[model samples]
Target: MRVERLVPLALPRGQKLQCELCRGPAGLRCGACCVTYYCEVEHQKADWDSIHEKICQLLIPLRTPLPFYNSDKERNHGLEQQLSREKHLVELTHRVAQKFLFEGKHKEAIPAALHSLRFSIHIYGLNSVELVPPYLILAEASIGLGHLTQAEEYLSQAQWTVLKTSHCSDAIQSKLHRNLGLLYAAKGNFEESLYHLANDIYFASCAFGTNNISSSGGYYHMANVFFRQNKMDIADSLYSEATDIWHSYFSGLIDVQLQTIMSPSEIDILCLPALRFHSMELNTIFIPSADESQQAEASQILNAILDIREHASRQQPMKTGKVVHALAMLHYLILDIPKAHELAMKALLIISYLQKQDSAEAIQQLINLIKSKPFYAK
Candidate 1:
């Protein structure tokens, strides 16, 4: 944890320096060089020249410290430590973008998504399923910004990366399939989308179990394809199925605190399919208000898990736009029109800068929405 404990760049040769902590042999060699482990000054003086001397100036700043993996437990711990930071940043970025998208402020989320993508590259590498998430976020933001072509381009890039990787983790593959299906759906290739989504569902079922939260996402996405095509009955059925999966998952994880299982963000992810399904049921296709009760229940569960306030607070600059957007929409839904307007405008500004690759419908919708709003009156 302390970079200072590391071998310093400037150390004289041959003086018998050894770390008091890990007991690792010190690289420095000087009679004055000494390493000690203590907090109080009294202890320092006693060990002065014995160990304290070498420890005094070995410290330096390290922006990206490689995980210290001297043992299996250490390696796992180190990875967990590194993963914690990265996950925090990624979650923050994703929340912002999600906020933007939910609020119909797609344009603003683009930049934040792009920045998140860089971190993702570091974590998942270029040709892994992990790339799918950041790419999909970017593509969606592009669509919001009226850069349909750019959205498509990023989606294609993600798909290519997924396919190219030989041994993708099941989680990654499921996510990739779900995203690809969504991409194809956006392009009006319903059948193609369905095919990919089916694959996503299959993989998800295997990865997370048939009744797992991960499986729900693919089912929910496939339902979107049917809904968009005006196959309301089929869409409704699929939505119901997805909801069942979520309900089962909720039952499974309900007693476990968010942090206890994986992390808060991971738990949030576990609930995402239900949240998304609720969104679809509420807005997209014309489902009777008779199901309003179900929507409310779903909303309550999703809200408790998603916790937009936390998501927004932790969001990174790379993903600030999207979090803002999602928050704006939630505000709008609650009748906080002013906040919604502000978020929508920010999303537009960001979207204007991205390439429109794969989302003609989304792009046009954003444009039309903005033009209709009083904020664009000037």
Candidate 2:
């Protein structure tokens, strides 16, 4: 719930504020853009040659009044073309915002995103779907910067806008609820957090059933609420569901991790894996059984599944590590020590990598679970 501070530029190691020029320090402000920054004036000036020149060009519209864009059909045509060209510029702003978010530069991201959103609105119009993400981004940035009331207000506006026409996409809804849940949870409003989380979970479940990444995210956050409540049984169940969904969701997307820029329904998705790993230390692992013959048969089938999973993990689009993790858990439950060890190690590697690189709570949870391997330690 506590949003960490943004890392400074020129720092040895940190999150979003890395200097673009040196990739060490945080940005301060560009005299031209008046928004982007550098560790120092020198870096800002040096970067002007490569990055800042283009960014300055992108800022041209922002500097001009809104009336110019609407100056007439011919001018509008030129403005429209210019806006189209700057589409990528907006993307760059979002990327910069992401770095800020990662480095706990939440405050910076809000303003940066605000600037970009304003430009986006001028180009795409306020009602355009393009504006939705920036609104959501600012809302989340507000949450990170401990501006919960502002966060809620921004999110509410975005939700109303999206729902005005069609129900917002499951992805957006999942995020909306997830953001609300995080804000409420941070405020110690567990009941409100739970309410939003529950809705998120339901949506995530539907998404999961249909193999939708958004819905699976819902289940993940749902598990978190349960975990916080110390309802281990329910939490574990939801965790299992979430792990499976994450595995499935990311199965086809290699090295493309689900970012921790979470929504209301997604905290649990990220947290559930971590919780499950914690639960493993209690010596309460479950294994399916029928008979000796059936166990062997099931183990054979599991091996086949494991092979498919491994193959998938190797491919670019299908990162099957989660599948490997679940399989490893199942292998352990079935008392297949060798298989469990292998798959567990594989899962541990993937989860560890994700945690290290992305700082996802779910992966961290899995790593903790691996570290507390009482059964395997001996």
Candidate 3:
């Protein structure tokens, strides 16, 4: 229920806040972009030539008043090409907000999220449900920074907006419930967290099929709640359901894997795997214990699922690792967690790497398309 923070370390090792120019201990900020820090005026000025110039360009629009992007202004080409300067600025701000959120730069995310929310009101009325996504992002950043009260306020506004909407999408409803669940979880209100999480799962199930991977995420979070309560049996059941959904979702994607001859001894577990879970999640979280019976059960479960897993692995090692990893996590709930944690981590690396590869490929394709376009200048 608690939102986990596993932001990858971005700055150079051994130091996080160093002068971009001189690599010195730093506190001074660049006046234009207000993103980079420097140790001295000299270092800040030096960066002006190499980095600040480009950064300042991106931040320039923020200085001007952000106006409403009237959707009514679409041109002959399309809405994308017809965006007014104000509309473009809002889009840019929204992108920056999301990027900051993804990078764990919560402080920076706040202003961008605020800008997006403010501008969104012009497009959709102030009380419109369309404002919820930005509001949710603001709440997420606030929670990341431990601003619990501020986060609550944001969620409250969003909840009110959602109530006012006569027609809200399941996706939006799911997100709203998910954030409420996580917020209550962070506040140590387990019962409230459970309620919101249950609602989130219900809506997500409606939007995405019951066996879809996204719905499995809802199941995973609910499992975490059960695990936190020390309800090992229920937690294990939830974990099993989540993994089964994941396995089912990926089963049809790898025909080559299905066709390949799989050795029973080298069976792979097929599914999607997640990393960056909190130690308090309980499912894969470690605690010390040595039980021969627990170990025996773990072994038996793996053996029993081997044929099924091998069938999945012959097509995609990435997916198989995830399925096995998810199963290992269920063991962590009912058996010795430390061992299961190890297996989960190993599987996580494989799937997470593949995920990155898929993302990078997509970005590269976009870049190629952009470059391939014919450019015309005024």
The best candidate by lDDT is 3
- Rank ordering of all candidates by TM-score, starting from the highest: 3, 2, 1
Query: What is the alpha-carbon lDDT of model 3 when measured against the actual structure?
Result: 0.57
What does candidate 2's lDDT look like per residue over 187-271, in tens digits?
8787898788777766655554464544544455556666678675675556555555545433322122222223445445435
Please report, as a residue range, the 10-residue window in candidate 3 with the lowest summed lDDT: 271-280
Give lDDT tens digits, candidate 3, residues 236-278.
5676676676444333322223233233532332211111111
TM-score, prediction 2: 0.49
| TM-score for all models, in order of appearance | 0.44, 0.49, 0.49
Q: After superposition, which runs of candidate 2 have C-alpha atoms over 4 Å from their true positions?
A: 1-57, 60-77, 95-108, 124-130, 163-168, 201-209, 250-378
Give the per-residue Cα lDDT of candidate 2 at 250: 30
lDDT of each: 0.53, 0.56, 0.57
Residue 36 in model 3: lDDT: 54
Q: Output the lDDT of residue 260, model 1.
A: 35
Q: What is the C-alpha RMSD of each candidate to the true structure, in Å?
A: 19.4, 18.0, 17.9
Ranking by lDDT: 3, 2, 1
